[model samples]
Target: MHAKRKTALAVGAMLAPVLALSLPASSASAHGYISNPPSRQAQCAAGTVSCGAITYEPQSVEGPKGLTSCSGGNSGFAELDDDSKGWAVTSVNRSQQFEWKLTARHSTSTWQYFVGGEKIAEFDDGGAQPGATVTHQVDFGNKTGQQKVLAVWNIADTANAFYACIDVNVG
Candidate 1:
């Protein structure tokens, strides 16, 4: 019995490091969403935009890079893609500031804003970790009328990004 106990202890000791090393790596910033101008997901949670699961986890709109969809190209957030859902449209000027509320701050590569499939603006973080919140100013140039803006938060050292869609009326 003593020999068996010693063997088990040794096995556990040897496995501890391996188990720790095998654990999944976590994102430096786990979750975040656009609040000002109110991203689709945020509005959903606020009850201003009717949605499904996104209403529960608005800050978790994570997906691979290059997704232009409002739902981050994720089916779980498909409600964001439905224009008929009466998403609250925020009125904005030609130049506007967008606020990102991060529950977990992660290393960031860049922040991009797109309108009608065109890149309107981008802010580079240069591989540095961001703060609890980030704000970006966007200029619409000459574009006007109702716009669906797709915002992307590119994570440094990772292939993933956080996406948000903000509907706005720009005059």
Candidate 2:
């Protein structure tokens, strides 16, 4: 073989593995969603609520860090934005435990909970990577009756966050 051709082939082979290792993991495999209390996306994935693409990928509702939309402004998962979609309302006490089932752990900044456009609670992780599952006991305060709670997982390394909206009837 020509010397130049042989050198080029060797370089390509050496770079292949490095390139592969630098690629990001699949989004679906790198994110998470609320499981307990059953967030809207969770309902879709569990077939409790009929949905589109979100039905297969509940952990992928990611968007800019401060977005309030349940679908994370992702048009493909717009069904989550429809308050009239008949999402099952979970009945719970005033102080509730919210559980997040993480597909892959990620470095976190903070976990925020919102209701009626007001931040009800926030947990700071100090940019540490979380475990396979995370749970936060959030007090509903004076708020009660039917409410839509928005949960956001802020990633420390990125300017984006994962979102889940859970409908609940607090007793």
Each candidate's TM vs. the true structure?
0.87, 0.87
Clashing pairs in 2: none
Summarize candidate 2's per-residue lDDT along 1-171 as a digit string, tens digits: 699999999999999999999998655445899999999999999999999999998999999999999999999999999999999999999999999999978899999999999999999999999999999999999999999999999999999899999999999
Stretches > 4 Å off in candidate 1: 10-29
Q: How do the residues 10-117 of candidate 1 rate in per-residue lDDT, one tens digit apiece?
A: 999999999989999764434899999898888888988667888888888888998988877788888888888888898999999999999878789999999999
**Candidate 1: residue pairs that collide:** 29-106
RMSD of 2: 3.1
